[model samples]
Target: MAGGRIADQVGRVLGGRYRLVAPIGTGGSAHVYVADDTTLRRRVAVKVLQPALALDQAFLKRFRAESQAAAALNHPNIMRVFDWGEDAEGPFLVMEFLEGGSLRDMLDSGRRLTVSQAVLVGLEAARALDYAHRRGLVHRDIKPANICFDDEGRSAIADFGLARALAEAAWTEPDGVLLGTARYAAPEAAQGRNVDGKADVYALGWVLLEAVTGDAPPVADTTVATLMARANQPIVAPFGV
Candidate 1:
C-alpha cells in the first residue's frame, strides 16, 4: 500500500492549489498522485513525502533545499519540478506529468528492450545525468524506477531525492542501512563511501543492462547480500550488448 490512508488521498487539495485526482504510484519515500494544478490550469504530478519523513524536521529541511536545487535543473531529459510546498499532511513536490510510465514498469511486464532501444534510453538518461552532474548535483540514486518515459517515448530521469541531499548534508545512515536500491548502487554507495557523478553513471549502466536483459544484474535475495554481491565487483555488460 502507499501509506495507509495516504493512498486513499483523493479529492484533497494541498496548498489550496493542487487537487489530488488519483493515486498514481508509491515508493518507499513518497506517494505520487496525478493532481490538477488549479492555478496553472494543467495536470501535474504531485509527490507527497511519507508521513514519517514529513515528521522529521531535519529531512524536511534538506528535502526542501534539495527540491529547490532539483527544480532549477533544466534539461529535456530531466523531469521538470514545477513547484513544491507543504501542507498539514506533508511536504509535496509538483512536477511534470509523464504518461509513458517507467522503465521498471516495462521490464516488469516481461518484455526486454532491443539493443537499440536500450541504448537510446540510456543515452537520454546519461545526458540528463551529465547535465545534473555538471551543475554540481549528484543523483545518488539512479535506477530503472527513476528512469521514466514521456508519452513521446523520450526517457527522462525523475526523483532526485533525499539520498542526494542526505549525502551532501553529511548525514550518515546506520551501518548496513542503504538509501537507494541496492541492486543499482555503485560499490562506493553500497559501502557508504563518498560518491560523485560517477556513481550515477555506474547505476545507469545497471539500468541499461537490465533494460536489455530483462533481469537485474544477479544479486541475492537479501539487501545485505545484494550489497555485498556488487560491493567489490566489476560491471560486466553481457556479451553482444
Candidate 2:
C-alpha cells in the first residue's frame, strides 16, 4: 500500500483507544500525530511506525525493544511515553502531548532570541541528554525539530524514535541508512558507527550554534566520512549585534 494511504488508514482508531486527530510531523521512520486518548480523556502524541518499517520483522522488533527501553527513562525534560502496543494496523507509541511546538519552528520564524533565552533552551536540552546518558541511552536524533517547547517555555526533548541503548547494535548495516538528520547528526552517528553521550553533546552544540546565529552550521556531508573530517573544526563566532 502507498504510504499516504496507509497513513490515512491509521488515522482511524487503533485498539479502540487512541483516535488520531492530525499528523504533527514525520520523521525518517515514523509519523507523529496529535491524538485523543479515549481511556484517559486527554490529548496525547501517537507515533505510528512507518509501513516499510512495520513490515520488516527485524526492524519492528528493534523498534519496539528500543522504545520500551526509552520508556524506562522518565525526566521532566524528556517526553513521557504512556504506552506501547501493536494493533491490526501496526505498532505505535503514546506519549505526552506538548503544545507550544518545535524549536525548528522557532528558528524558522526568524525571531532572534536573547542569549539568555537561547541558553535556557540549551540548558534544558543538556539536562535531558544528561539524564538519558546516565540511563545508558543515547538520543541519536537531537535536531531542533525534535526539541519542543511548552507554553511555559520549558524545553523537552521529544523524539526518542532514533535513540538506542548503549549496549544495542548501533545501526542496521548493509543498507548504510543513516538514522538521523544530516545537519545535526554527530560525527560518529554520521559515520554509521556506535555513538555515546558525546554524540548527543555534539548535536546539542549544533542546536546551540543555530539558536545563537539563526542558521545551522554548515556540514561537509551527511555521511560520517565528511562529519569526522570536520568534527573538530572550530565554529565561527556568533553574529555580533
Candidate 3:
C-alpha cells in the first residue's frame, strides 16, 4: 500500500479497537479521525500523531504527558480525553467526538453571531479555562480553530496538543514555529514569554471580540511587539456586525 493508503489502514484498527471511518481534520502535529470504538460500541474523535511529529522524541513525550494531564480534567466545556497511549504505529488520543464544526468555519460562512451568542460561547470557554487553570494546565494555543461546538450547540475547547501542565514544572519553549494563531494570541505568548492562565483569558477576549465584531483586532508585525502593544491598549468594543 502507498503511504496514504497504509495510513488509512493503520487508522482503521488503531490500538486494536477504534475503527477509523474518515479523516475529519489535520493540524501541525496530528490528524483527527471520526472513528468507531468497537469494544464500547460508541463514536469517538481519534487523534493520531503525524509521522513527522512522532519522530520527534521531545514532541512525543510532551504530547503524551500533556494529554494524560488533560484526560484527568473533566469539564462540560472542555473536550474530554478518553484515552492516550502509543500503538505500534505511533501515539494517539481518543476523545469525545463533537459534531459541530469549528468556530473559524462558522465565521467564514459570513454569519455574524449575536452578542449573546458570542458571549455564551466565550463564557463556556472561559469556564473551561478556569477549570484548567485551577488544575495548573495552560492551553497554550487558543484560537477559533480550537473551539468547537456540539450537536446541541454547546461550546467545547479542543486541541490541547500544545497544552502544558504547570504542575510538572517542565517547560518547552516554542521554537521557530508559531505556537498559536497570530491574531488571537496573547501578547505574552506572541513575545515568546512563558505564559499562564491569564494568557488564555487574553486570547478568549480576542476571540469574543471577533465573534461579535466579525473582525480580528489589529496585531503588530512581530509577536513581541504585538504583546507590548496589547499591554498598553484597552479592550476595544465590538463593531456592529
**Model 3 segments more than 4 A misplaced:** 1-11, 87-89, 165-180, 219-241
* Cα lDDT of model 1 by residue, 72-169, tens digit: 99999999998888877777899999999988889888878899998898889889989999999899878888889889999889987556654544
- Candidate 2's C-alpha runs over 4 A off are 1-11, 165-180, 220-241
Give per-residue lDDT, candidate 2, residue 5.
Answer: 59
Q: How many residue pairs collide in each prediction?
A: 0, 2, 1
Model 1: lDDT of residue 114: 96
Encode model 2's per-residue lDDT on 47-159: one tens digit a residue: 77644445566666776777787788889999888888776555778988999888888888886557898888888888998998888887887788888877898889976
User: Top TM-score: which candidate number?
Assistant: 1
Candidate 3 colliding pairs: 187-227
Better TM-score candidate (2, 3): 2
| lDDT per residue (tens digit) for residues 148-183 in model 3 | 989999999986644442213233333222333556
User: Scored by Cα lDDT, where does model 2 land?
Assistant: 0.73
Lowest lDDT sum, 10 consecutive residues, model 3, at: 165-174
